[model samples]
Target: MEYVSVPTDIPDEQTPLLEVYDQIGPKSTFTQTTVNSLNLLMGMGLLSLPFAFYKLGWVLGLSLLVFFCMLACYTAYLIGKCMEFETGVGKLSSFYDIAYMAYGAPGKYFMVVLFSLELLAAAVAMLILFADSLISLVPVLTPFKPQIMIGSILLLTPLTWQKSMSKISWVSFVGVLSLIVLTVAILWDGITSPVGPGSIFDPQQTNMWPEDINQIGLGIGLLFVGLDGDQILNLGHAVFPSLYLDMIEKKRFGKSVSITYTIVAMFYSLIGACGYLMFGNEIQPEVSQNLPLVPSFNVLLNQSALSFIAINPLTKYALIVHPVNSTIEGLFNIYSDTLTILSRTFLSFLVLLIAIIFPSFYKVMGFIGAALSFMTVVIMPTACYIRLSWDSVSWWSRFAHSCIIVFGFGFMTFGTYGVMTV
Candidate 1:
């Protein structure tokens, strides 16, 4: 979608550090770009919650939040580098081309491989999850399970198959809202429930190490690694236009990226901490799958008329939220069993489908590990942007940052290899 040119009344100092492109290409119908990217990423980050709880318990979950913070800081820095080098056109190859513009052919090729591979893996993984959800919903449809999986590839192809980032942004927004409602309900039950224990940190417990650090390490690796692919790439896709706005322009790209990172990281950390605390070590495999088992909604959705309302939290929340923004907190107390069955059915289908395709849990871990590690930890910041920004920073500071990024890449590579071998 073509971006409308910013009004020219702004001061000379207000223009972006980088030259602003009047149009961000063909305009899209998607309105909620920021919201979509935020929720999808939070979903991926929270996907690790159950495993984190199982392996390390709540304490380690909190510790992992610290790691997420570090990762977010790094992400923001890379994004600023991306923005600083942005050439106004927000195409899929924007970052790769920007790196090329600043550095050369080597830099461009590296980014393309890194980003494209990572995004492909991410899109496939999400589609896998989507198919898995469907199969669990209708067992008799089992014969067509493979068809359903392939069907999703076809279904998503149009939605995301089109090159329009704006439309993708909107779809992402709907997906994100569905996720947010589920998250809110889960957290509400968590906090107000009888078992509520407010503090996330307890200083008295000293033995921070778990009995099996390998599983713990692997779980930790998966938590951050799954976050790459679609969500971050989408961020690169949508955020560039907004970053060119006056407020963001004067602050420099770093502050905007920093704010975005901190907000998103804190959100995931809170939800992960809350979910683990509420569910204890028995955290669900993925948040969406566990929605069916959520007790409050289960009881409320028992009736027939309200049954259809529970198909998936995505639809449920949107229908209610669309007409009246205030309806969410108003009617959350009402539950319908049909809604329960529907959500659970969806959850069951997804789990079974994923199990079939990725028969071994290790495959999920391995694929996610390699793809995310390459994109987030190794390729984008370290290899591509770093090459472009090599002279962008002072020599000593640049060298130190490069060393740290390299260390992160090495650890991620080691973890990916470990997942494959194990």
Candidate 2:
């Protein structure tokens, strides 16, 4: 049996030892479906939900859904063009590769730097959310949160080290299952709960704030983080870049892209819409906390039961709580508090892992109104233009392009600091 390996560092000459490119291509039979499901599930996770819910409510959520539909439609069109080109000789694994192939070595380098920054920013945002969640869950844990986060990273690093891509994929698949189940349960409960006479479409009744225009704008800016093009771009390598091409050759590109994008858009929009209708301004930790007040889900039930067992006998009996005699929790807590220690360790690791891995915000979005904003915005379009029109490209066009990509780094240096402080 052949085995494939995904390098810790991308763009290296080391081909996977397996039949598939562990890093770039679908390795296991489970890769495609599992990864796709995870994509939607992660998109709808606790971290992303509440803010969207608070800002849009059900009405705007639907509007956002429509926007996603449009986005998918447009993306599918690009993918179709890519397929028509039959440009599958080279790897389209990362934005940089796509840019490099479409443009030149310079374009490739530009994309790498740009994407790396974006990933870093994303990582930071996740850390911020993780730290915030820890503080909310256990106030006393606040003082040690940062330490725990860092420590957890050290611990997890070894476990994740030398692990195969398939392993990572499967583990992520399992984690996503838990997250999705929790989210769906929460949303279902929220939808069933009673609501006032006002329509979910009504902004005023939905607790939306048209009064805070700046806030709305900020919310839109933040949405860009979630609507990131990286995920789609990543699909280029994992799936056939020629997937659209193959379909097109078979006269199926149009239908395939259309159906796929529509499905993805509708799914996310539905999740977001449901969550928004249920939780409004009070929504903060979008993915995790915004569920309905009813505590029926396992995680919620477990927490409630634990709380009840501590406070009152009637509530404990209602939950049918039984004290552990020699369980893991008991053994650990009997002599030392395992949950607290483990929680601290786990939360700390996630915070640091996210901070380091995801790119900075400015790197992802680039400066608004900048001429080179096009660089960060459209990978394929810019690459295609550069490739086909390199020599005949206008002097101004070249100048503008250079400015757009260059100024982004300068902006990131300053913008990152600003973001951290703010």
Candidate 3:
């Protein structure tokens, strides 16, 4: 295991590690990488943004969205910088790889466990979304929610067996477009519909601050789940190194990351604000559910939203679970195609089982965001940066890193309690 070892000598910009990364093959162009990052950043999580906004009140919600977006970008930047450290022959490519490089065997084990759990939790949430959407769209499936979930697992199991991302990239693109359409529909509906007296966007409604302390805490947890891309398993902070390595123009990798997050943040703000303004406190966990269901134009929007919700998860389910499957194969040294299929099938079934047992989408999201996202997006990167740069960096840099770590832990603690109690 080649870890990014600590250097006795100060590493300048022209270090051998930097030179090695420069020599590596660039498999993706800047545009391709940016699109991929955007896709990963915006997923089913967008569906929960409205509820998060309503919980926190409009002003606080928007502020938190911007804050978290900047935090996510900064943490990713730190991961990129840390990956430039000496890791023997090759560069540290994944979140687990960086963890191992930074903290050896213990860190590797911890990251593997966290990453696997996060992936599994995400898969479970997707299945829950699938079953809920199906039941909502097709009334006949209402009583058969359990069966629908089981069927979804069976349908997605084969797709997971396909080992290449390129095969599913088109479907991923369609999924992204579906979300965009959903966002447009939500915005359109919110603007056209009559605002109720208690609507958050209404002038008569209470301004700015949330009156309920409990709701604010819970909202923070839910907002973290909605806005934080780190909960997406394979493509969070872990993805920076791979993106950096794949870029045709290595120098522009940082700029690309910033652009990707900025675009994603804008989308989140739009959806969250629109959805919350439309429904206020009555907002559902999934924004699609909040849309009016009638026999007119609203019906068309409702069906479109539900259809996309149902289809999008199925399309991205395989890719979402890919990291865990690959990790298992690597751990057990299983190279056989047949075994790989079996492993994916079993894992998919397990995730479906969990979904069936705990079908609360927002709750699951809050739990995952608090437990896993906080560590991956905040704590891990800060810890690694401090470990690698402690002796060489300034006191102010160390103090800033320490504050981030503390903030991560504090938020995680508050989020966990909020989710559990709410």
Which run of 10 residues does model 2 get worst, by summed lDDT? 315-324
State in Å the error of residue 239, model 3. Answer: 0.9
How many residue-pair clashes does candidate 2 contain? 27
Put down candidate 1 lDDT per residue, 122-147, tens digits, no spaces. Answer: 44444445444554444466467567
Query: Could you tell me how far off, in angstroms, the CA of residue 15 lies in candidate 3 after the best superposition?
Result: 12
For candidate 3, the per-residue lDDT at 365 reads: 86
Order by TM-score, highest first = 3, 1, 2
* Backbone clashes under 3 angstroms, per model: 21, 27, 0
lDDT of 2: 0.40
| Best first by lDDT, ranked | 3, 1, 2
Please provide, for model 3 over 3-83, each residue's C-alpha lDDT reduced to its tens digit, 9 standing for 90 to 100.
Answer: 233445565645555455545453678788898787667766778888888777778988988898888888888887887
Per residue, candidate 2 scores C-alpha lDDT tens digits across 1-422 of: 22345556545344422112434432323223333433532331224534544554455545644663454344434433443342435324334445666777877666555544433333334333444444444557767755644643564434322212343333333333444455556554554445521113322225444334333433333333333332211222213333422221324455554555566555566555555554555444344443323343345632432232122211111111111112223434543444434543443354366554432322222222011212354334434544545577698976764554354344334333433432
The count of residue-pair clashes in candidate 3 stands at 0
RMSD of each: 11.9, 12.6, 5.9
lDDT of 2 at 55: 50
State which candidate, 1 or 2, has the greater lDDT. 1
Between candidates 1 and 2, the one scoring higher on TM-score is 1
Worst 10 residues of 1 by lDDT: 320-329
Candidate lDDT scores, in order, read 0.46, 0.40, 0.76
